[model samples]
Target: MAKGQDLRMTQEAHVTQGPLTTEAGAPVADNQNSETAGVGGPVLVQDQHLLEKLAHFNRERIPERVVHARGAGAYGTFTVTADVTKYTRAAFLSEVGKQTETFLRFSTVAGNLGAADAVRDPRGFALKFYTEEGNYDLVGNNTPVFFIRDAIKFPDFIHTQKRDPYTGSTEADNVWDFWSLSPESTHQVTWLFGDRGIPASYRHMDGFGSHTYQWNNEAGEVFWVKYHFKTDQGIKCLTAEEAEVLAGKDPDSHQRDLREAIERGEFPSWTVGVQIMPAAEAANYRFNPFDLTKVWPHADYPVIEIGKLELNRNPENIFAEVEQSIFSPAHFVPGIGPSPDKMLQGRLFAYGDAHRYRVGINADHLPVNRPHATVAHTHGRDGHLYDGRHKGAKNYEPNSFGGPFQTGRPLWQGIPVTGVTGETVTPVHAEDNDFVQAGNLYRLMTEEEKERLVGNLAGAISQVSRDDIAERAINNFRQADADFGKRLEAAVQALRG
Candidate 1:
């Protein structure tokens, strides 16, 4: 008998209803198969439901990021553990026990969307904090420093890391050639080849606001700050061989690990710390504090513990929450602002521009990137695919109808500047030796770690075509550590033999 007739008859005996129906209240018929041309031919294009499904599927993917294309994300909360109101009047860090919802994305640089998780590359560590003031994005990286301080070399550096135009594959010569020419990359290259390069898992790594940023107070006091998110889970890494095996065994290992951990209630957490430098100290500092390629030594500026961030929730839908998410360093609240870091200043524009291209002009309207607090006024009119509810209110600012206006207070502190405006190479200080910290880091490693580091370096460097380029790259290692250079040279020679 038909199910509808059976249901009606059984209703006399108080039987329950069946499954839900379609939009027209008609019971769905044969959801497993689409209406096709006579059982075994082409599918009929006239089937509206089938056409709708296929059309949506075809447009499911958006443009991948130019860099940091592969990533994993989760939702979490940040709890203030210490009062930092003296430095900055940001509400989220002002009071102890105050909690704010946040979303974080950890990614690998120089990889496509389908790349391996264990590549020896810098990881993007970006956070979006939904505070009462607004959504403040701390777009950063796993390492505390970058390859170059200037923005002009960014495009060139990225090109070298990407696939070669002729071979359509990663060219080690291209990578080392760029590094050899640009000495500023020494510090970051040291970190990349070290044990921390191939982090065992995302939870076992730290995150850093690599560039110095500004923190302003209500009293107009400004402080330069560097953010550090120390992993409560502690640092862990895989050997080069182990990482290679895992890349083949599980390309999505990091993503799967995160999801499973959250499901099993093993939430990951990190302690938030900051190194603050006075606005007046930038001029007299031994090293240029604003340079993205350098670090302010702990002896000069120590870290102050401020809060804890705990990731307790996995996104229900990865595409909607993680893939569509966007973060920009320019997204700042009243108390926070950008520093004079050249590379950082470029990223402040580049990140937003990339997001607009990959996602949409209305990308901010997406649920993941949207501000939790109500947006009072924005002059941004319409663009491709806008989802915001724009009522009859006047769209333009400075209107008679009380549109959002500036508060008239200085958003950041004005530091003293006394240099003449001219086009010339700025003189680097005598103490700005990029090789020192790198050498120190190399010397600190254990014998086994050193061997693995040498092997890893040689494995990539041996693939380079030019012998002089290889020698120059080895010389960089020699500058860092003599034994490091000797071991890497032996490894490469053996490979050639």
Candidate 2:
């Protein structure tokens, strides 16, 4: 703990709602004093109120997220500026000048709840759009491409980031060992060690819907789409020294900066843009557009600006509003849907399952997660922390007693699947070679940026005890770019000496 910092928690200044009452609604006589034998005798065990308070307090914290445990969020407005009704029938994007209420959460991918905010990590850019139809979520990241194209490797990749079970401390060796062995990670690893890895602030970093999504028009024309939230603050980064010093000086620097900016009426904003492709174009593209490890180059399909995003309000209670907020890819509207991206396909099920376990089954009923529009039909009830709605009603459908019925929403035409049914590796596409894009990204870096990238990679690789793993990592970079490979090797050798 920092000097003069109290380990004890200060009392909450503000709380929600009316006078404190028992869970069953009997008025409490006194909250401050617990039942006890007269004047310093044995404390009574039959103190129901005291027991309830302590028990609830003990169980207050749910499981910290597997990834993205530390985060900051704000309430925002996403206003449509250009009509894209021909591309998507989602009500929020149906007309110009239409506004949709939104909540956006920014988080570090691998950090624990207490980790520093300014560390070199990809920030999660998740937004929930409470449209008239239903709540639609765009779960994305600060970077466009990912470490792996398949979700099956997600657990193993996360295991590398987390504290070593044996040592209970993060080891650089574990991270590099995995990355060196898994050649698929080359592109994202290049990105991680680049100039933009340590974003100056949440406001300055751009966000991408890392996986391709499917969108359909009212006329049932389907097109693959990707979202890009270009930050109005402009791109900025912190060098290694600056980030280290700031992390020690103020762990919550990013969180504080955002809140203070909003309070001063300096609202942070992003221009909502998208790179759209015709549904048939994926097959003929140089790379499989559905591959999560690759991105659709902007030169081919330029970003089309469609809306504006501004965060004007901070949360009233961080825990209640921000921490409890949930975003899932499965929460799609009629027009916007998922693609054949394997990672996305897995996330469609995995995200909701994780929420149900971490939050309750009725997580959607939470104010932050709930829709502003009326839900015509909702299934499943009777869970912990359930909202007091649909009482004494049939939980199932197809009942005669005026039960909730499904709306006649048009389902998009299904894409044909031709793969053999079995547990197997993702088939090698013609452009499955991951080195091309990583090399392209490396070549795009300025001379100074390239120097820093080599330094960053060397710093981590030098800590790796295994010579073979270190050599393999260098070889991966060599595959990316010859100059990059030699520079990193020379840097690491200097560090070793």
Candidate 3:
């Protein structure tokens, strides 16, 4: 029994191999029928086994996630390929050729547990690395930018994406109305309506740690970094028509594709890279580096190739590995820490809290989420599923008997801050206008891509019942680029008519 060994690789002797038994391990005399009083009289209340079976069956289900409920996961390895000690002293990236066990879960943002996977929505790229220091989770999305920059607007943004309380369905009016009011959503709106909106499969799309994060070296030099996981399978996407047909035919299209691909021994992989910005340069950058609505152009900070990630195995039990898994951006190791990204800051608390409520407080003690290389020593004890591994050890620190003590070293470096802390807007950067990057993205597209994007936007916007809502949404695009707006308006009008 090695620490954190994959359950699939272990010997099956521990599994049930004998006659059918109750949960208490007692052999059952009869399992086919309930122990009724002598040939179908009133069923006996003394049938403990029957009661146990019925009770367990009734308690089988757990609450599904509010978002990202439709998901698939696989076990993988992340091997560092380049030296990056100058940027971060994280032990997982301490040297070239360092390999770490990883589990990656890909999911749709707004889908329910039974929702079709081929919908046009952002995919969650949640990766958990079981490193020697501790588990490090990089929870991100397929898109590099998001709809909103601040955390307070997150609930409102999601409310639009979800089913309307009154309509009992995801109304186009609610969605367009929210986006129309929030001009900051323009950049991500452009992405969502583009060709990449509906990914052909999980393996065919790239992943991004969309928010800026902090990395520090042993010498205390800090650098702001963004992560990119480029799919080695190459980018593949589905058109709106193609996605609709696929979803209708196979609701689990993306899940089946990923599973069958790995079953054929064709493992999917990604070329991992990061764009590093020195700490000193972040203050006066052209755009606010911490803005979740914006992306730092490759021209400003070139991506540095660092590692390779390969998914080699699929989970034997989907319930144990995929459904029960948890990830949080706050799960960082030494040298890696949070930046001032407002969205990221809010997620640091929200994600962990969600898991605590959804999965038990001892969710981390589960083999899927636990550390592989080292045991976690903590004072917290006695919760649902707690293994009681710390038997008889003094729970309190600084006891007469030897007890675990702190090392007096912080895992991450701190930053200098000033000014009063209150409800204040983000500090303005010189080139922080919301529409500039959206316009740039529109301009970068080919003529055909531009046409498809316009068609997608128009089709959805035209569905809105209110003319004011549709116009406001179109005006945001118009602000991005005049030509783009004109074409979109004409297309929307034709569809409306």
Candidate 4:
């Protein structure tokens, strides 16, 4: 034996198990084959193990997400580079150089689970930070704005973007009709058809909170902030033709690329930044800061670099860590809370509710959604597939038998609101012109990018059977820019001819 090698041996050291066993510890027989009717016949249902495996497989799939069904995820770390404790009391951001374990999921909205990864759709950029206080989930998207600001129209808008019931395929008419009728969608629609629409890959795109959120400090001073995860790899995009070919050639392009990149040690990273606006400024801002369809121009509120996010680990199990992962905008730690963003307010309920329906009441018990910090108190108990961690602890609160007691300090300071309670429309800002930003974005595009944008829009719009729908969509584009509408119209007409 080598000098460093252990040469000692014991009689029982090499003992091994006879065979595999069931979950109940019963030794499994005929391990090499399933109990079937014959060597080449149908599988026998009487084989409990086989039945269990098949049954589990059949029900393994949960309800696909209503939006952002196609996604790829990885584990990463977020390190704070700046001190913003005066702005937020969140423990993760309290000190410079603090790091938090994070999981990020990038997705394509309006695509099914098996759909093409390179589809022309807005991508979901959701991040969950495992902090000592609790998990903070920043559920956002690639675009800085959304199609609709109001939650009531969200379902309707999603229905339009999805496959048409009659045709079982995406119809441009369905999408355009809804967009033309809902003027609020104009801003996001312009972005959807622009150069940034078809991102080259998940790593090459930026992520935005899209809605304003409130951050409160220990002194109870609150500030409205927006998160921006600017890709360190720089923004890159695929042209319409390139995207289409890639989609056809490899529907799992983005997913495979992320996994292979990590395996090759080429970890992707992003610079975490924030645009903070004083609560007082929001009251006088030119645009409604809470509107989901508008972005606070970087010039008005410059981005302050906060930290960096580097994704270095691929999930060990896709189903457990990636598929079953749940994130809600409602999941906020101290110092962070929702703003008056209407869509966000609705999501605070909708996301949690969706998780309950899809992943059960104990969705939080799942390893992916579970917080790294210990949970001392919870009123919720005895749901489907409960793991029974509560054990002998009292289930009810406010009891004298050593039940959990409430803390005196509030989670965060609430913003003061003195308004009438009535069914009235939200007040629009005085300088709210939906076309200005869209026009500016269009003008900012390079000539080649603009050509691709025009071609992409014309190609899709030309597929609409209804001439009026196409015309209405073109008219909205015309409102943004005359040249844009003219070019799109010409391309669309040429295709029709």
Best by the lDDT measure: 3
Cα-based TM-score, every candidate: 0.85, 0.86, 0.87, 0.86
Error of 4 at 154 (Å): 0.6
For residues 352-469, could you state the per-residue lDDT of candidate 3 as single tens digits?
7678767888999998999997889887789888889889888998677787788887877777665533334555588999899999999999999999999999999999999999
Please give the distance, in angstroms, between residue 78's alpha carbon in candidate 2 and its true position after superposition.
0.5
Best by TM-score: 3
Candidate 4 lDDT by residue in tens digits, 368-421: 888876563686788885888888888787888887788888766766665433
Global fold similarity of model 3 (TM-score): 0.87
RMSD versus native structure for model 4: 18.7
Candidate 4 regions with alpha-carbon error over 4 angstroms: 1-62
Q: Write the per-residue lDDT of candidate 1 for residues 1-497, one digit (tens) a residue.
A: 99999888888554236653444455544433344333212233344443343333223335777688899999999999998888898877779999999999999988889999987999999999998888999999999999987554566688798888789888888999989777778779878988999998899999999989899887878899999999999999887889999999999988888889999999999999999997877767887777777888888999999999999999888788898899999888878888767567556666776777678888888888988865635777689767557767688767898877777765566555444332223235547676766777788788987887787788888888899988888888788778877888899888866
Ranking, lDDT, top scorer first:
3, 2, 4, 1
Error of 3 at 109 (Å): 0.4
| Candidate 3, poorest ten consecutive residues by summed lDDT | 35-44
What pairs collide in candidate 1?
none
TM-score of 1: 0.85
Off by over 4 Å in 1: 1-62, 422-427
CA error at residue 4 for candidate 2, angstroms:
47
> How many angstroms is residue 492 displaced in model 3 relative to the true structure, after the best TM-score fit?
1.0
Question: What digit string (tens of lDDT, one per residue) describes model 2 on residues 1-497?
Answer: 65344323222322235676777777777653344343212223465665554444323336877888889999899999998989998888888999999999999988888899999999999999988988999999999999987665566678798889789888888999989888878999999999999998999999999899989998888998999999999999999999999999999988898899999999999999999999987777778787788888899889999999999999999988887888899888888888877678657656776777778788888888889865636657778788768878888887888987876775344565553333334445566687989999999999998999999999999999988999999999999899999999999999988
lDDT, candidate 4, equals 0.81
